[model samples]
Target: MASIEKHGPSWRVIWRYQGQKQRTTWATLDVAEEAKAIVEGYRGNRTAEQVYIDMGVLTPEVPVPTTPTYREWAEKWLGSKTRISPGSRARYKQQFRDHIFPTFGDTPIGDITTIAVGTWVNDLRAVMGSPKTVTRYYSAMFAPMKAAADQGIIPVNPCKATDFKRDQRADDDTGEHKAVYFTPHQFEQLRAAFPERWRVLLDTLVETGVRWGEVTALAKMHLVAPTKRTAARVRVWRAWKRGEGGQRYLGTTKGRAKRSLPIGRDLYDALAALVDGQPDDTLIFRRADGRELDYSDMYNDVWMPSLIAARRCATHPPAPRGEQLAGATGRCRDYGGTRDSGEPCGARVRPGTTRCPSHYGPARNAVSMCGCDGVLVIDQPASWHDLRHTCAAWLFSDPRMTPLMISRRLGHATLATTSDIYGDLMPDLEESAVDAIADARKSAQGTRGKGARRKR
Candidate 1:
């Protein structure tokens, strides 16, 4: 039997098992009654431990271990992640260092309450300056705690109760990171801006939509049927990625999928010419000295200059006071003249052209002939990866191309990935579907009318 007694404002349940007395306190009489029932239920065959279990005070069959500090568990958790890529491991370590350790590292894992986690999340958002960054830090913190909970070191993951919204800005129409692409004509203009030696590389990028790592890893042996004018294909087997400490290494392509993409006649011819006389395993693209292409050098020295020259005019006037006075001295002799505001023209000029695009009429191969230096500045800034975006855009322009086709071409692991990234660029699928249904119905009605007339 069990008994209930009132101690001031609170209620207490009392009971005895064997020879020892047992008791528990509750804030309300209703809870006291429930506790009394649980105490009485264990009277016949069950023990006191069973009664505690029934009262929701003890978990059955499992022993609670000493709780480790958050830092101890996090370190152990990170060390056990042996399968993640080196780059990913480095990023995770950095997150632990910069975000996780400072606040909760030394605290006992069991002491991390939900309220504390929620407060810490708010602090992280304030310090990190963006919802996206806060979310990443939160994930890093949550992972270790979750592992601890799973292993029975903690009762529950406090992070699970913390609320944080995923940053949706990337997917919003006005997102700062929205994908931008160039038209074929614009691509040609950009290609022409590069020196003749580098144009083939640009062609491969725009045509194949392979990642930069895959492009850099392309070898002569990867090209199959190199002499075929229209049906040549490039096999993507591996990719080059820079590991931690800036060491370059070869690895599986993203999603670990190997795929082949067909090359156009122009690209095939270009590749055939480039690979002529080279060893089968030699890289198709390299520096002038035949060393492996350094991505940083390529972007800074080659890509940026070409992009600037292709998109802008040299409106920048010569140095005002120094040797830049037109024909006054050495390197400044060819500086373009003054701007409309009488300021020295600061716009960059084409290599051989005397004036910036603003002053010059048009380059021989200029696409729009608008002679507007503002175009490049106003358009979405281009990055190396945007070449992939350009390829997707061109593929989407064709009404016959499907998302699955684009996904295969891009070597993506799933159709959903392709659709999620490039769904906006796809032709109006709903409209096309409705139109096809209407056309089918119309054809059926015409066939029935003809049948009725024949019957008549």
Candidate 2:
């Protein structure tokens, strides 16, 4: 039974059903009277669903929606990912902010359809202008939705039906999806360009094939020498990586696998000179003022300038117009016919030339033709990681080296990775396999011929 009562200028509806009391306040007596009638009707024998529908709590054709919005679910999912590395967490947060939130944040998890998701993916690809970037953003968006579906919050994952392909231009730019590396001659030229103090660091990078983070984290204690006559080897257990806010910390290597690499005598001697009497934990390489080396600072101040200097053309003739070269800035080295003058030419040289237009011949029409004076001009610039690729290339060039040996040296997680990356460089192995098969067939034929003759 239900009743309406006036309580301090407001009308209240009170009801008793299923042995429980329920009450609600209304501003007017008329509204409270209507609610009291509806509650009184519920006193009769009826299903809970019929009562709920009569009270406008649920529609006859639709059940109550319990699905959370995308934003709510994403927050819950991100909070549960506590085991991820700090860097990865930072990246996920960034991806959510930059890509996922703007589009699907307010949408209900159940309401997100496959067609809507496909449109969103296409929009991201169009706006981001890179398929690789779109792929990453798509993955970030998919993770939370997939989790929702797996937990039964949603019936299906919309992302599971969409297909995204990486941009072909990206693969073409990065050496046809293969690792880009330096040749030995190019490495030597780059080596000579660096200051003597930093040469050992470059040597270590080329010889050891360790990652940039691992090499930067090297300590004196990590080097081991079994005997005085033997070359030392580096034990790689940890690496230094930048986390959120550019904070640096030591962590395990990429594959989470520790490895040891043998160092040549030259490298060992160089390292010994640097850390002879220092503490076992002292860094093997640092700035001139004893500060930790930052990759960006070193690249901008030293690497690019050195590379430019090493590739400058020395024999370029002076311009026909006798105008100063367009990009000239650095110190010139061409002395012309004044070698006996006992002074360097010391004039400002152009960017693509070793000397000013007056000293060197004319600036060549093509940049490739400019650096013909025994200097190698690299068409594509190489990053620090490319040094490791160069090491892999050299190892693959040797017929004696096997994939397992290269995989261990490069610290790859599996032989398949090494084979997939450097498989194109192993063309000779295919030829050898074919020859072996042919030889086996020829030997079987010869044996058959001999047996027939003996029977005869």
**Top candidate by lDDT:** 1
lDDT of 2 at 11: 83
- Alpha-carbon lDDT of model 2: 0.73
Give lDDT tens digits, candidate 1, residues 1-456. 788999989988877665677777778999889878765543322345655676787788777335778888888998998666676677778898887888888998876777778888878756765666776788888988999878877656888865554443323433233666887777877887899889888889989999998998888899887452457899999988657676888888988879988887778778877879998988888766776788788888888778867766556422222221242321212464456567777665534555655555533223333556433432555777889998999888888888789899999999987866776775576578899999999989888856454544
Reference-based TM-score of each model: 0.65, 0.65
Q: Over 4 Å off in model 1, which ranges?
A: 1-70, 104-175, 226-230, 314-378, 433-456
Q: Write the per-residue lDDT of candidate 2 for residues 259-294, one digit (tens) a residue.
A: 988888778888878888988888888766665688
The 0-to-1 C-alpha lDDT of every candidate, in the order given, reads 0.74, 0.73
Whole-structure CA lDDT of model 1: 0.74
